[model samples]
Target chain A: MRLADLGERSGVPLATVKYYLREGLLPPGRRVNATQAEYDESHLRRLRLVRAMIQVGRIPVATVREVLAHVDDDSLGLTVRLGAALWALPHPAGEAPGAPAEAAGPSREAADDPHRAAADLLVDELLARLGWSAARELGALSPAHRALVATLATLHRLGYPLDADDLLPYARTMEQAAAHDLDRMEQLPTPREQTEYAVASAALFEPVLLNLRRLAQCEESNRRYGL
Target chain B: MRLADLGERSGVPLATVKYYLREGLLPPGRRVNATQAEYDESHLRRLRLVRAMIQVGRIPVATVREVLAHVDDDSLGLTVRLGAALWALPHPAGEAPGAPAEAAGPSREAADDPHRAAADLLVDELLARLGWSAARELGALSPAHRALVATLATLHRLGYPLDADDLLPYARTMEQAAAHDLDRMEQLPTPREQTEYAVASAALFEPVLLNLRRLAQCEESNRRYGL
Candidate 1:
């Protein structure tokens, strides 16, 4: 298929498809002549995946490129690919205090950024206490750690006063959910299929979890407020 | 305190605070003279919340205004206030196939958007079958509905072939998590505290849920690859 047909068939705009090509998000089609190139089914598949990550998953282009590179690299093992995807994706407050939503209050800078250190320590203690060894195994500053630390910092600044005990249950709940997801993915027959399933779970079905939480929140609010 | 002091105490930049003021995210400070105005602790708190929503939560300014308006409107009940926060947040893929992530292939336009309608019906049936009555109460096109439908469409386009049965476990998991969150929030004594907690959950801690999922994915991948 020509570039135009790739755009038409994929339902992605021609300009957007060209942009992806320029960004190296979508690999260039086979060079048919001086001015024209041809795309194939593989390009179509890649295009859909790129669109899914950028458009649906709301991942930035750089991150998308990193993640796709990992997904396409057969030299890396499945776990490495998975880690690559996890690392490439954005976290809630990984940037922390500078970002407003998760920023620590004035108290954060008090006494040599004690709040930051305490938040970090608290997360370590919480994980150790909860026995989430897999997460701990990733080291102290992994994406999960960054995310957890940021949440703890934000909670403290917000006056919630959460401790390790408060977080253990949530961690356990997520562990169980992840276990369930992995159990399902394990049944797939091929590594490629499994990787695709993992990517799909991360990219597409993630909203199911978040949306369900919102639904549950709505339900609870209704129960409490009788709305 | 004056606006400068308000900005200082909140640790938000004076210019950004002023922006929030002009944007109606922060209520006007009390006028003290022709050129001066007095602010109070409430203003500081509101500023922090506004910052949290915009910076950490990544909510649009317009949505923040709508949410804050609900939070401040005493005429509204607790349920209404809760609904207000939920309503103001963005859905994962509320725009659907129109967005690239879930664009249906050649089959999408064959029968005048049947894929969309089918996806909607599948979500509705899934909720009903799973007995997620609380979500159902929000009607057919709630944020949760929009999110779920978009996810369904994306999964279909991605060739995942999911149905309600496949999603039941995930919905159940989130329901359990929500129940836990609400149970904790209910421990707070006043509606103000509860509302603050609710907003924090929706904004900051929500990342905890997402990040934990990533952690779980990494762990599962490690296990699969024997890493």
Candidate 2:
């Protein structure tokens, strides 16, 4: 099919399709002539995936390019590609050393560096692993991706000596909170209600994070003042 | 009082302090002389708040600037400012229309757009309100935040129609699923174990979403083949 037909089928505008092509997000269509190019089912699939990453994931084009490169690699699994995209979202704390190795496990050693170079690498690796894991499972969900990235970036900028190990505690906290949150969601007693609950729960996740932080802040304040 | 002293007191490096000032994230200290600026408790408080917004809230500088501006406005409650900052993280789902009339109310007549623009706005507002209430109660737990945002973004991209009337069912579902997930988490004994469970759960949320999608896909496939 021609570009117009492909656009019509995808329900995306022609201009947006052209922009995707120029951005190298879409692969070149079969050239029928100097001015015309044809698309196929693969193009449709790729376009959908691209839209998913951009609209849902809210990923920047440069990062999307990197993710696409990883995705297109035959050697890498879907999980790994997803991880790369997640990792590309933002810098995390304790990222200067052998973070990835530590995140992946003992197979990789933490090398000593006077400048904490090993620590930086470790942080980077750990984030990559976490990103990959999150992406594989949660590619359909973009807000979570943005929230995590934003949180990580904030922590990084704050000079917090964070690593995957430190993050483990926070991650655990979030998981428990989510579990509790999800439990409350299941009481609705209908399939439609269940789906609605999923959507609502997902929407509420950020504010829940904020409220939890307030709780943590209260706890911190109590500890600080010996209240 | 000097930059070095302030750095030591805040545990922030002098260079980083300079960077913060340059980024407009921090105000310059009082100029004691041509070569030195004196810092004080207010600076310390501001710095900490900045750090929290950056790290915990994951707000960007531009958004942070807006937040700071709003925070300085005494008329706005701190909770309101905080909520606004959190809301700002997710890119606008297009311009928000008028405030929603009420939760669980009937859909309003959408204006010119046949796609029910008013209804969509009403639903988004309702969801936002639901999120705000949850945040006030639950605290900002990262996993929940990510889950909710991702789900909303996905639905938005999928062109799901929503309205205020849709909220009650959605919330009811979340309350159920969250409860179910939490009950499983509590089976693990000890706070530390609970913490570990939380981390694992964070890792697991993605898988849950993926599995749900997989189930849906499988059901669709089975129906197609009469399996």
Tens-digit lDDT string for candidate 2 (B1-227) = 77777777765667867877898867788888898788886677556555555534445678666645544445543334333333333222221123122111222333434444443454346546654444333322322333333333334433443444444443544443444444554565643333323322332232223222222222222222232
- Per-residue alpha-carbon lDDT of model 1 for A90-191, expressed as tens digits? 665523346443232323453455555677677778768866667777654466666666666665664445777777777777777777777887898766
After superposition, candidate 1 runs with Cα above 4 Å error: A1-44, A60-62, A94-111, A158-161, B1-9, B14-43, B94-111
Model 2 misplacement above 4 A:
A15-24, A27-42, A51-66, A69-227, B8-38, B48-66, B69-227
Query: Chain B TM-score, candidate 2?
Result: 0.43
Across A120-186, the per-residue lDDT of candidate 2 in tens digits comes to 4433454354443433333324333333333333334333334565444334334444444345534
Best by TM-score: 1
Per residue, candidate 1 scores C-alpha lDDT tens digits across B33-57 of 9999999877877787778777767
List, for all models, the DockQ compared with the true complex. Answer: 0.44, 0.08
- In angstroms and one decimal each, the interface RMSD of every candidate reads 2.7, 11.4
